[model samples]
Target: MKMTDPTTSAATPDEELSALVMQISSLSKLALDMTKVCIDVKDKLPHVIAAQAAKIAMAIPETGETVSTPWFEFLDAPTPEEMAARYPSTNGDGQNYHVVCAGRRPGLYADPDDATAQVTGVPNYVREKRKGRFEALRFYKAVYREGRAFTAIDVIVSDDDDE
Candidate 1:
């Protein structure tokens, strides 16, 4: 953000745009630094940022002016330990099942519906050893599921019933 003001600079239109981009990049870095220092805000950062982006989009009065909002695609996939910490496994009917997503009907469970209950070709032993690498990530929908630990994609939930 330590750049000369674009208005002050007698630069071309392209140069002015470049300066704006730089300022935006600096703001993003500063936001990221804040997240690193603030542990409590990390979980809520994505939602807050998205809201701001949406606000910016709405503020633009120009017709067909598309405002690109940030996506969780940049974030790294959650580690096994992170998965366990975020969504711990729940024991039910003498079987282990982790409530990965919240929905009317029970979403994909940790153990798949198979004789061996292996998911994504990963054995249960390795999954357990890793603390839930395959077991948690095997469900593709879980990544975008409500209350997921790691952000992957945004999902619009129309169902209001919480079972």
Candidate 2:
């Protein structure tokens, strides 16, 4: 059968078939590239998780404190009020504050447990302090070993221009 080219309005079945094949080949290559990108991300997933876990571990206190409740199972196991009291003000600026986890600023509160309304509202509280700007007190957990037991290291975030 005779075939006509749609774009050029010319009868060239061989050329049309060749063009279609090339287009298909290009699409296949693109799909392969995308698959590779996905695979790369998947391959790095474990490392990312491990890094996050390490950070959390570092945030705990070195005293080897443990909590009975699952809610307070964090490293330091500080209550919301305790955290607020511990860091009453950032750099003693006379502004009361709350603690939030690291990630985006103003960051999300690190309250895994349904502690209190103040803990839940930490993000909003910080945002209000910054006049609607997002900010957070990032905490990190680390582990150091002397012999057998690993000592927990509490890493507090300091004010930096990079943040």
TM-score to true structure, per model: 0.20, 0.33
Cα deviation at 42, candidate 2, in Å, is: 1.9
Off by over 4 Å in 1: 1-9, 40-163
lDDT of 2 by residue, 1-163 (tens): 9776677777389989999999999999999999999999887676566645654553443476763222211232333344346544544453323333321221223342322333332221112222211232222111111111111222344569358
What lDDT does the true structure give each of the candidates? 0.43, 0.39
Instruction: Residues 19-104, candidate 1: write the lDDT tens digits.
Output: 99999999999999888879767766785566455434433435875535322222223444454565545544334444333222
* Clash totals, every prediction: 0, 9
lDDT at position 108, candidate 1 = 32
Worst 10 residues of 2 by lDDT: 140-149
Over 4 Å off in model 2, which ranges?
Answer: 1-8, 60-163
Residue pairs in candidate 1 whose N, alpha carbon or C atoms collide under 3 angstroms? none
Q: Which candidate is the best by lDDT?
A: 1
Assess candidate 2 and give its lDDT. Answer: 0.39
